[model samples]
Target chain A: MGQYIHLIFPLVIGWGFAFAVIALSHFLGPKKNLKTDLTPYECGVEVVDLPSSKNRFDIRFYLVAILFLVFDLEVIFLFPFAYIFKSVATVSPFLMIEMGVFIAILLVGLFYVWKKDVLIW
Target chain B: MFGWIYIALCSLLVMFAILMVSARRPISSAVFLVLTLIGIGVLYLMMNAPLVATLQWLVYAGAIMVLFVFVVMLFQLRELNPTSISTHPGRFALLLLLGGGFLGLCLKGVIVGLQEQPVIMMGQTLVTGEASLKDFSLLLFSKHVFAFELLSVVLLATLVGAILLARRKQRVS
Candidate 1:
């Protein structure tokens, strides 16, 4: 509890600071609004249809996002493995083989995705 | 003070979950869902389970929500209109029933927890070094080793399924 109690102070400070800045902007910032200011700007360069609700996106985006989801979870599983592999290493040398096999399975999944040609675009 | 903070975080989580379910735009709903997920992480932090909280944020709020938002955007590819919210009276009844059921379960959990106290699921409270991570790793690599490998197999299956799902439309055309 002592270790976690220290986190509370930082949480309060971060949230308080954010709320203060946002409230200050609300109270002190200029309220005047111009039509041009409302319009979306295209990087202050050639306006090539700025990203908005109206623009059509690609289905590949979903596929890539799913792929990312798969591997991101795979990466997360590594966190616990790494956190205690050293401890386990001394106890059982076979632990490395276990981790190796786990990783190799995911590698096969990666290979399958690569072969599917989803990684091209 | 900690109790008050915990209650506040819990209330915020409930509010955020409500906003997520009933939001107008899909993107906004996903954003609200992220807030709810982070609120859950904050709750975990207060419980002294820093590893669970960190994983909650990194994997759930960060990675999973990114995928959710991208999928929501992908919906924009086929349709321009905002996804319509349910308006049927039966839908309202169903929502209310689900909401009430969830609230009851949560209330019951709180009551039972308060009566029995929190269960320490192993680890003699690591005050100095790594806390839950070490305990979790021991359990994962020892007790739940088979489940761990099975997760990889499931992921592989999902990868294959997703690729096939995505390729179906292209093949049809």
Candidate 2:
């Protein structure tokens, strides 16, 4: 419990500070009311919907997110590898093969995404 | 005193976080959030938990927050209206009071703990330094092996789920 609290304390402090600052800003900042300001801005164009449109976003957005996640997880695995590379190299040549397989999977996914034109803007 | 330094760092992080939340552009907010995360990571380092600091960068900043920013950019949500946020004076006051009480309790607890231990500032021991990487890897494989496997499984699931979610359904025209 003590260790947990020590680990969590900084996060709590950060969140608390963030909330307080935002709340303070609300109280202290100048008040302005205008329809234009309230309305959602779409690439500098006026929003067609009065409230807001609930349009489904293109799948490419999700594709990009998934690609990012794939790369991020790859990096996570790489960190430990970096730390223990020398020891692992001495112990097992198989480690390189395993990593190669992992990279191959990621490469396949990337190729699939590319073929689907998900990378295009 | 270290207290003054802590306070200064905390203030800087708070200011950055506020700027992040209030920034009109999502990309700008995302960038500010990165700074805030790094600031928090530095706090972790100051607390003498390099492992936790690395995890903070790897998990929260590197993965989760980037995903958040990617979604924000993709969706292109309009800037939040500052004024439209309903303000309740009494509720805000109560929340502030509660927050203060929580902080007071935390401070008291920390002081007591420090007094008991005399807060021995551990130097870079073999276990906590670059030299310990081999031991760390051994510990991960032996003791934390289950966690390592579970993380892999989670990543695999995430990949499959993401691909499924992104797959476009063909319409029978």
Candidate 3:
């Protein structure tokens, strides 16, 4: 229980600090009222709808999310490989082959996306 | 005094997490979510899991959260008009009772467990000598080989599926 308490103390301190910062900003910030201030700005374009409603997002958003997940997971493979690399240097050929297949699959997906114009900004 | 401090912090984290979930503005929610993550990270550090705390920040706050923020920015959500609170008093009462019951059970368990386990020096074991990064890497590749391979395959499948889902259908005119 004491160990748990010790662990929780710093977390409490950090949260308190963050809360104070946010509260201070809320109280100190300007409270001027204007039609323009109320309007949503989208890349300098006047927003047509209220900012909180569900809005259409570009296909790029999903594309990027997928890409990020793929790459992030792939990076996890490096963790174990790095740990045993010294003792397993002799098995480098097999490791390279496996990694090659992994990269090839990702490359094929990238090509398909490019062909479909999903990669185009 | 220390116990009170911890209770205060946990309450704050829970409050921020609730605000993050219910905030109408995506940006505001994202900011609060960051705070929640940081609070959790600090908790991990206090537990003497500095490596886990660092990973929490790097993985959740630095990487995954940036993607969330990027998506929010891409969509450019606007401020939402406030709405009336739920009027279902019975449902609210039930939810409160269930939550309170869970809390009581957890507190009872903790108190019971505390009577048996004594607190030892928290950081002494880890402070003796740091494990080499090489040891961790070796364990991952050798012992966790199947998991490592499976993750790679999953990534490959997700990449293909994402590309396929996001593809624009070409209309034949």
A39: Cα error in model 2, Å: 19
Give lDDT tens digits, candidate 2, residues B2-98.
3434555666677677667656677778988998898798777666567667788877788778788878866777766653222334544554554
TM-score of each: 0.70, 0.54, 0.57
User: Looking at model 1 chain B, which ten-residue stretch has the lowest summed lDDT?
Assistant: B120-129
CA lDDT of every candidate:
0.75, 0.65, 0.65
Model 2 Cα shift for residue A32 (angstroms) = 28
Cα interface RMSD of each candidate: 4.9, 5.7, 5.1
- Scanning candidate 3 chain B in windows of ten residues, the lowest lDDT window is B121-130
- Model 2 misplacement above 4 A: A1-58, A88-121, B1-3, B11-32, B51-55, B81-128, B171-173
lDDT of 1: 0.75
What pairs collide in candidate 3?
Answer: A51-B78, A51-B79, A52-B78, A52-B79, A80-B141, A83-B137, A83-B138
Candidates in order: C-alpha RMSD to true structure: 7.0, 9.3, 7.2
Top candidate by TM-score: 1
Chain A TM-score relative to the true structure, per candidate: 0.72, 0.63, 0.59
Candidate 1: segments with Cα more than 4 A from true spot: A3-36, A42-55, B77-131, B168-173
Model 3, residue B30: C-alpha shift (Å) = 2.8
Fnat, model by model in order, equals 0.70, 0.27, 0.42
TM-score (chain A) of candidate 2?
0.63
